[model samples]
Target: MKSLSVKLFCLLLVVLLTTPAVAEIVVEPEDITWTTDAGIVTFQIRFHNPDPTAWADEVSCTLYAQDFGVFLPNQNEIGTYDVPPIPPDSFFDVFMEIPFDQLPPPPEVHHPWDPMKVQPYCTPDDHWDGNVDLIWAGPGGAGTIDSHLGTLLVCPTYGASEIHVVTNCVINMTYTITGVCAGFTVQLVNEDYTAAPSPLAANWSGYIRVTADATVPIGTVCCFTVNFTCGGSTIPLILCAEACDCGPISNEDLDWGRVKSLYK
Candidate 1:
């Protein structure tokens, strides 16, 4: 019995010594932020690894833009980034600014009345949808992961214009326009003679200024449209403006003083 037990223990020890240790590694997307200005779009994404012991010697990401069939040769690579070794269970953020020249120009489409308009909207299924390919390598081996980053909406920029407010109040309103790849201008059109400032260019801060006519009287509302023109394409936004004091609120209207307090 003792000789048999000794042989069995030797066999188990040999098997344990020959087996390689498996490293647990995982990469995940944390957040993605996008900004556009002057017909250019920029993207910043944060990623992290969950494995505590394995370290990646290199990490890379590839970005792809999905365009409907209206544009020829869709699925283009917008940007790429490579980083040095990333420690286990650490976070990394990468930024890429896509130039205007690399962006696909707006496609010419038939008027809204034409049946061909349906063709432009049909094929790509999701004009703004995109994909990101992530590759990472460790001392043990290399692996790849992919993620569908959701809709980006870069072509033919337009936004929902329905707004409610009190009449005769100088209320300030801001709008966020997405998928604006080319330089564009925003203007209030057919406002029924409503007093408003001239159109402003869509910049990094997606802000549009709209003012109500004080003389128009209280308890009154005006419905109008805002036009976003870029790359020979125009998107008319139907806006319903009413009287009310909603107070000024916008993504760009950040209180830097208050932000500094948090750090202090």
Candidate 2:
């Protein structure tokens, strides 16, 4: 009887000691903060790792933009990290660089001519810059609610529109015009607004077919003057400029401040 009681006590102790305890891993400053120089935005994410034994061999972090609902509106897979183990209750910083000329710019970037004096409704204005929100996902507590990060632009560079693009091959042009550029719709039409077969379209702010009659060259800006016909009458829209085959990815926005940036 004594031996049996001892064994039972030992088993209970092992169970109590070995059972995993869940400590919520908290990432601080829940939103990503950015700064711009040139045209790239280097996002600095600071986190507090509560787990001593928990470390990551590789972590995949992604950035996305959303509209209204939490569902992914538009997402750009930023990249991954090979973060080693983080000692328990430790703090660390991780970063990703987004070039102004490459990835579409954040809508909040201010433009000189914007009448509202509010930042461009959509930035980098290379793509639909309006109504898009940012999201961050990763491993090592990445997907968990606590692991995600929200982003807000602190200081952003503007005027990405003047950059040039050079493409060697023939291209397709797509167009869509919203109140401030929304949705992806493509239609090809002649100068007189007639659809032309085998028309090339550009995929931007939603794909649309360009006016076929305009003989736009490779480096020339193919400006689209469009009208959005939606829950009402025709809404006029303008795409100032677009270029193809610009250059490699660059993060013009990577300047850090005295404070830390975090994911909320």
**What TM-score does candidate 2 get on C-alpha atoms?**
0.37
Off by over 4 Å in 2: 18-22, 28-31, 50-60, 65-72, 108-264
**True-vs-predicted CA distance for residue 139, candidate 2, Å:** 8.5
Q: On a 0 to 1 TM-score scale, where does candidate 1 land against the true structure?
A: 0.35
Candidate 1: tens digits of C-alpha lDDT, residues 33-79 = 55556656776766665667656555555665432111122355777
lDDT of each: 0.38, 0.35
- Top-lDDT structure, candidate number: 1
lDDT of 1 at 248: 34
Report RMSD (Å) for each prediction in the order shown. 18.5, 16.6
Best by TM-score: 2
* Candidate 2, 56-157: lDDT as tens digits: 323444444322111123545444454444556776577777664454433322112222222233233223222122333344545422111112211122
Give the runs in model 1 whose Cα sits over 4 Å from its true position.
1-30, 68-74, 104-264
Give residue 53's error in model 2 in angstroms.
Answer: 11
Q: Candidate 1 — number of clashing residue pairs?
A: 11
